[model samples]
Target: MAVAVNAAVTLPSSKTSSSPSIRFSSIAPERIAFSKGVGYLKNGLVTGGKAASIRAQVATETPTKVVKESKKDDEGVVVNKFKPKNPYIGTCLLNTKITADDAPGETWHMVFSTEGEVPYREGQSIGVIADGIDKNGKPHKLRLYSIASSALGDFGNSKTVSLCVKRLVYTNEQGEIVKGVCSNFLCDLKPGAGVQITGPVGKEMLMPKDPNATIVMLATGTGIAPFRSFLWKMFFEKHDDYKFNGLAWLFLGVPTSSSLLYKEEFDKMKEKAPENFRVDYAVSREQTNENGEKMYIQTRMAQYAEELWELLKKDNTYVYMCGLKGMEKGIDDIMVSLAARDGIDWLEYKRQLKKSEQWNVEVY
Candidate 1:
């Protein structure tokens, strides 16, 4: 059990930190220039200036209109008219590449200026539709991504939303080279490009109303998005009505140091409030576990398994995990082992956490 502590700290940009050597030199240059937000694109693909601001809606649907796979919850959940059939048009504010010049993957910090009409809470996700007509002459479908900004918006003005996106590269089964259609579309977005957005979707990852509840977060790669929102609400933004008095411990995993998105901001918060914030990194390629295996978040968790178990037993603690679903078993394996130390059945123990609404997971 720990009480809140306060301190001041600073954050350093990614450019000033150590990063991995990028492996894809050939396909990278094209993506690099389009990645910097609010910066000049030497190729003239983008207009150089401040991106348009948020606060006006375009494209509304009628009440009788129906959208496929509606995002509303069962209890007549609050939802906006922006559905798959009709979506709000958002202006591209910025697209800044945050990874090193040689990192293995491409990660971008993107900001979308939205009309103030999209009401949302922390931990919700937004869907993006790439501009193009499919072979059937229909608009490309919307792809959902977690919202990386706080509920109050990037500036606490409810004017903008943000996302951390990674470019996907893979070889197609037909022996053709391919990149993610939607991901590259977003990565290539120019400052003035318009995007279709829908839904503030999902409440599973939302933060607890209790300002003093301990938050244990585990994320890998772009999964860090929602945690960014949680942290911003807890430390970065000032809510005169809400003051954080509990501890937040974040465990993050990545292929290399360069792949750590928002590292500067996380470090800044950890430094500013050492008593209230803590961060742990598991760089798979850069670090190794005691077994000499590549260190992932699971291995890092094992190192502190006992302590984590203690925290889980506390009713005030809530554990949230967001990332690729593959890591689920690795995490569960460790949890099972740790719970055994207390003479408890791990599966049953997990059930209790879920029943109490203390365990939240959003993975795919």
Candidate 2:
């Protein structure tokens, strides 16, 4: 049995770093502007000076008051009352195009901005509304995508929210080059395209706030986006604090090495938390499988079941699953097998996960 000698080394971000006041602000207002103007269209409701300017314009056009009054029924019974919430209502843009991949398949990375802040826990997703009708005269469709950057990276002082997207290719009833409305429109977008989007939903898949909690991230394909957001939230913004004592592990599965997103950033994260962070690459087409078939994270989990189980057994450990739709079952089954080998009941293991909120899966 070979026990890996991985010594922990605390990076500069750990000391007084968890506090934003301590960590040297990475994204300045200027950088935020550049990201909003140049990068993804960003979310539409993020609050900041940039968004405030837009809201001021809207207020001038629409004079609305926050009225607080109780509605009375037949006997003067208070039925409903209007209570003011945040006062700031987010505005959505319709069909705003930002960036596109002009390949055979029309994939995209669009952005939008908002008048109010749309704060989110890392790994949360949002809903998108497509434009126009399909070839079959159906209304535009809706899809969900995870936020690739942190709220701190894009909101408050920042002006944009970024998203990683893939165009859906499907044949409509007309048998023409019918494709997904929103995705195709996004794919054809130039720099100034715009669209409507709402929300930062999903409570099940969220990063633990405790800096000491370990994060085990597993994803395939574009599923890497939310993990990237989590990585940056844990490593980049909080780097100087030396406060995040948690171990961050990333198991990324892709078709090929070339298709691996954020390779450079992953290298940087490893350099920052050499012992505290570990990344496993599962390239199905590029690497030969030990079982003589295409490799995946499921197979990798099986190969290192004991170690994976040990990592899961640690205190304050969190598991996040993303990417392909079927991975949750495969990973869960592997964990169950490992639990059975350790004389732990599968049902108890699940209860433990629920109690600790250790197991978090987001598949689409």
Candidate 3:
């Protein structure tokens, strides 16, 4: 059962306008639907206050047990075995830093020994339960991360799984430093450490099966996790079941050159299949655009939005975007301008893309 969380938020009335804005705090982060322009409900309704006063109650408690019947996707539904309440205890095999020593943030490549039949696909995620108690003296909840390795595992032949986790640390409003519980716990694990893992969850980021489909992957920060899995499945692995000869363009953004993750692996793949695989980087701190502004993923996309608009017209072009939710608008703006140049309504075009299951997004 979820505990009720009732928050009395004050919306300050403007001197000219009749209503004020709604400020929401003390709500569960998982329940809040934050976006680029406006906040929305889980069901896709905008939460913008149309009235002077609004009363909202958020269910802040996490379900201790989750046994969903199935998770839906374009590839049909998959019934996952592992879940939060009944999790699998797996052994940590390796914990290595993927980022350079001079990087600003700490990102790691963690591998865990699969106990037995813990099966997962290319884009699914596993839930990790930290080994500690929260303020309520209860066990810490599970945190989900996209699996960074192929279903066949690291060497292309094992039952193990991997993750790309960044240590989260930030200064709070009261001038206090806080660290994320599960991230720090995973980052600090040793070779023999025991971790409670659960759920091969999430279906939105799943890959299409067409071998000739053009894949446009846009990612930033640790959002590169799932794409890493897809790359491995396409170029590195020897799975004859899925042969990919299509064009895969990856646009990744990072703060520094040292922040590039799996840099060697991507280089090797590009060398092996130069014509089929392409990877572009937007190192913000190290490079600037023609406009003298710091180059981000959006800027990199704008450089070729016209070409991308052409590709979007193809029925087989699949665009997968996973990163900070804030980038949605910038990317949208770029596409809007490019679409307008050809007298195409980008809003309706995007809708058709979604209806065709060509546009996939899994942002945080």
Clashing pairs in 3: none
RMSD of each candidate relative to the true structure: 15.8, 18.0, 18.8
Off by over 4 Å in 1: 1-80
Q: Rank the candidates by TM-score, best first.
A: 1, 3, 2
Per-residue lDDT of model 3, residues 23-90, tens digit only: 34334332232111112111001122421011011112332332222214444334367777888889
TM for candidate 2 is 0.67
State the C-alpha lDDT per candidate. Answer: 0.71, 0.56, 0.72
Best model per lDDT: 3
Q: If scored against the real structure, what TM-score would every candidate get? A: 0.79, 0.67, 0.78
Q: In every candidate, how many clashes are there? A: 3, 38, 0
Model 2 per-residue lDDT at 259: 58
| Tens-place lDDT digits, model 1, residues 231-285 | 8778766566778899999999999987787777776677778999999999999
Point out where model 2 deviates above 4 Å: 1-107, 134-139, 154-156, 170-178, 239-242
